[model samples]
Target: MGDTFEAVKEVIVEVMKIDGKDLSMETRFIEDLQADSMDQFFLIDGFCEKFDINISDEDARKIKNVKDAVEFIDKAKA
Candidate 1:
């Protein structure tokens, strides 16, 4: 996996309170990880806080999967 994937996975693991070892680029926040609605919102908030940037609703809406999140944050950091 790329560095970007690793970073985003870190946020997902931290926010969802799941095992880091269990997270992957293919991991689904809801189905695979069993994350609820609150976990979803908290994941977004935690990601923003970790990156020190605000991810707009439209941009966030694109993040349906881990790959999308990595791309989003990679762009934001760039």
Candidate 2:
């Protein structure tokens, strides 16, 4: 989970162009990071490219926070 969190944090930092020092499992994409719809799209895309996993639209919609993204990626990669 630590590796997954770090990986997800890296993706978020790259895609969002924000500092990752404050990132955490409870951080919210829209609420905390102020990620718009396009940001979310790129985030999902980035995650797919980074983890080599396909995230369906339905599944993508379910990822709202850092924990959600990390957990989803961990599950997909598992």
| Native-to-model Cα distance after best TM-score fit, residue 68 in candidate 2, in Å | 0.3
**How well does each candidate superpose onto the true structure, as a TM-score?**
0.83, 0.98
- Residue pairs clashing, model 1: none
User: Candidate 1, after superposition: displacement of residue 62 in Å?
Assistant: 1.5
Candidate achieving the largest TM-score: 2
The most accurate candidate by lDDT is 2
Model 2 poorest ten-residue lDDT run: 69-78
Task: List model 2 lDDT by residue over 1-67, tens digit each.
Answer: 9988999999999999999999999999999999999999999999999999999999999999999
Residue 77 in model 2: shift from native, Å? 0.7
Q: What is the lDDT of candidate 2?
A: 0.96
Q: Number of backbone collisions per candidate, in order?
A: 0, 0
